[model samples]
Target: MATVTTDPFVGRLVDGRYEVVSKIARGGMATVYLALDRRLDREVALKVMHPHLAEGSDGAEFVSRFRREARAAAGLTHAGVVAVYDQGIDGETSYLTMEYVPGTTLRHVLQDERALAVGRTLELLEEILDALAAAHRKGLVHRDVKPENVLIDSSGHVKVADFGLARAVTEAASTATSTILGTVAYLGPELITSGRCDARTDVYAVGVMAYEMLTGRLPYTGETPLQVAFQHVNSDVPPPSDVEPWLPAELDVLVCALAARTPDDRPVDAGAALTLVRQTRAALDPAVLDRRSVPASSGTAGAVGTAGTDRKSPDSGATAVLASVAAVGAATAGASRAAVDRQAGSPAPAQPDSTPTTVLTGIGPASTAHLVTTSAQGDGVQHTLAMSRGDLAVDGPDDGTPSPRSRRRRAGWWWFVVVLFLAGAAVGASWWFLSGPGAYTAVPGNLVGATQAEAETTLRAVDLRSTVKEAYDDSFPAGTVISTDPPAGGKVRKDGAVNLLVSLGVKMLDVPTGLVGTTADSATAALEAAGFEVGDPVEDYSDNMPAGDVLAVSVPEGSSQPHSTVVQLTVSQGPAPVTVPQVVGLEKEAALKALTDLGLDPSSTDDYSETVAAGLVISQTPENGSEGHRGDKVALVVSLGPPLVEIPNTYGRNVTEAEKMLKDAGFVVEVRHPQGISPLNIVYAQSPEGGAGKTAPKGSTVVVNVF
Candidate 1:
């Protein structure tokens, strides 16, 4: 009943069986702890409900719901769903034990990275969808599906957790409520308006998550929870492309459709939503399509093309179309120059036309022109050009016969070419500077076998430096140079450092000897002392070695192997033959103890034997002193001693006299043919064929085979 606070109950023993190790997570209703199940020798996540909440009027009802939900979650076997192991009450506390998953939540991932690449983001999303779809098929709805509820393992596997809030759709609570119970960011509109929820509701939340991942921001924001809830009820979800224009429009539309205001407007269910995602993903790129093998459609192609067009050139008026095209072309050219500079390990190049220019050119037929300029400083060649009459002409400083329009066009084009030339020159110079230096060379000498410090001093005389990197080699002596980076005769850079790989000497160890005929434990200890690990020790019944002694150590004595290699010891359990002990004529307990002393269990059978005393062993299986191994069953026959006798002449006696006589003889009486006229009540027939039986076991069924 205690509430978990900052001072959690970690390392506390509970019920003398479980020890809490650490708090794994806490929710509004319960705290989960990673605990050691000492009795089972395994780790478990124990979710303990708050004590105060457990005592409320609805407490019993909620407890029942929690158990039911936990059982339902446990029934699921998907790898993406966390496995529930056990649930019970420890004193007054209610806890459910589950598999412990070590990982961070998707919420933590989002908080740390803000955004992930599209491929990684989609992969995680699809895994979440797969888990949800499975849950939906089982008629369980996970009321909360958000970043915090999704866990990502170190290996990049995504698992859905915390199904405690899930409700079976057929449950009365789900059909009766309209108010929301989950986080506002992921709440579906129907959950707010009508208190109704289904699989589509979860699909809507997944869509919201996808939107956030693509744009690095939530689709909706409000001042308070109520305001956000209201938005879910009234607003239409915007396409992700509206925020990040680079996102594929088909994907944006699919995500928006999932976040639709009405549940009916969204996909049919989580399964359908997953299908749409796969189909849309497949149609976007051939690689995705081939891997997923979903068919492509014309509609998908057109949607992608439209998205590209919308992002190509922002200016749209017919009069400015030509100018816009030219501007886009220049922008693309500048982007290429920047890319080239980046690849060449240089700073980005300057834009061709930092400012736009308009000009008129040609003497016969003048035309308006837009000019863009670029600058390069690498290769040192510069040229300029002018445009007129739909033709771009090279311009010269000495051409004197120039119209005003031609002169204006020539001036702008010349400026554009000069800028590009300067940018190209700069890119070239950066490439040359980065790729100039090569590895350092060693000066001619006997330096190949010199120590690292000696080599450094000699290399410094040639304007080079030396860095020693160590390695193991058999051909080179320890602490001696194995090789140099540039070799001895190669050309050396004036300021480059030579990297040396030195020898650590050949690997060698003495072969272990004399391990046979010793105990496995002793052999293992000896091997470990010699830097070897112990492998699984094999046991066999040996003819030559005594019990619990080593027969031979694997990897044989005097045979060299790697250091720390596992050496397996084969131990002897001794010979297989042994003699069984005699237990007959002894008391049953004494007989059992005698067999047990020989490492055998006495298989017992009880019988009445006139010759043997009561409670004594009459006989044993395999006879006495038979040869057998340990664990062989030894059957024993214990005696009850003597049998029951029957009453004589009871048939002719009166009823009372007969009953008393039979009772005195330890015989039970039964009247036979009571309804027949039989010599005025004198008995005529008796069982045991009338005095043929010698003795019968007491309490044995004496069926006068009943007439």
Candidate 2:
């Protein structure tokens, strides 16, 4: 059974126009409700920030940031981007309404399909990048990019959601101490180190997602989030072929370049990334693009056709570039190569040599002799790039001869440098304690929206202590910091305490009872008076309840709702009345049944009609279109045929005589020549044959046969 999560905003009108029907979902910053735009009579997804966040001291700032981001996201008009309609505040609740997409998220899809085929992954990524490119073109970056934010609609079309809301892509001015809004698994190296983010950050995240989609597992996993984060900063995201060696070299190059340790190696932005990906896709062979993807954990390596691969595959580091990416993975990588191509202006790349050498270069220090060998390909294109760590590499020939005396000379120089370092360290320590980092350090700001642990870590780094206070918040997740005591960017003495308001989760309310006996207006007023929001009244036909009176009421399962809680009331319209239908000119039985079916009492009276046939209704009381209750009396005058009359004998008589006789008998004369037209104009037979007991209605036609 689904846990009933109560929502206070349900059945409540926001801004006097949007009616909250029910809660749809809750995220880190807001609770989404399926709401009705009363003015437009359409449904929209309404995102409402929890009271703690929206009503905090920084509420104005949060709202301003939210509005700004929403506007930027709204500026993006694309089929793949979720549309933002409006943003506003009602009382203390900050809300943004957007298009309501009905579908499962890409995260859910990944949960079912451990790994998607190459063609399918490429297809999804193309659409995702297409949308991201649009935002990047507008100078907007979706700081958070992951499968969870990708929505697959009912028709299988993709929609990217939570763009600017996650956090706008900003310059790398801040550091990791600020509230990092994206999933840790997909955070870029720049994002992990500095609070700053740009289009490249999104590109990095997309690269991680692509790796996960193709490998069925994250590139890095650790016991703690911090461990994984450490690897993201310090280690290279190995080629996907490391796990599944059958994967093509282009894929390895693509993933490595996007997930490069530094931002500069990756595509400049999502647009650049998209351009690179499109080119790679076009260059990829069909067999490789549509190849079935098996999880790397499956331990199955097979010989199959792949981009620039031999019939039999070689493991990663042999045929493809290792974890290091240098020349490719950028929009300019191709153009730079074209500039050096033997055949200029050609769409296809030039054949360099028979072997492509993928080199691995270490950043910073500690290059402990790592060598990667490459294989020769039939394509005869040798791609070579080499970078050396001059300082870390040993400077000696392979011969076992005694080296020059430079080692001893270098050792003497190192000793002299150490003496100087000791003298400088003594001076540095004196300044470090006196008005330096140890003596006075600013409190780490940017704690709001960060997790409690993360805030504490940041404070610890800045020589400040943290104390957390708990409160209920519908928007912020449990254990999430809702606000900071001194606000972000405030200065404080070293080791000072920075208080935090942490969320205990959303609050639930008591369900309102005894709504069936009161009038709709009474219930609505009472609910509204009790700090609850009233939804539009629902009406239905009821036998016992009087019109405008309450019939039923619906409440959420738990009391997650607080002030502005939604209250739904069902009003009775009383018993439905049936319209009396016209029975005149209808068959007696049909007319009677029609009234009976409508719940009206049907009764008939016998009468002779001159125009209406026998057993047909002539007139009805309480005429057609008049409303009547069930079992209401309906009087119908049924015809008993016109007044019967005797017909004169026309046998062996002139046709004219028979016609005249029928006319005199108050019947219409219709002469027939079944026998044949008689020269004597004699009538051979007549309808009813002028029988003694036979009679017809007055003005009814009579037939006479002439011989």
How much lDDT does each candidate structure score?
A: 0.62, 0.69
Per-residue alpha-carbon lDDT of model 2 for 276-367, expressed as tens digits?
A: 57656765666666665555355543322432222211432222223222223232332222222222111222222455433332232442
TM-score of each: 0.44, 0.46
lDDT of 1 at 482: 74
Best by lDDT: 2
lDDT of 1 at 614: 86
Report how far off residue 513 is in candidate 2 (Å).
64
What's model 2's TM-score? 0.46
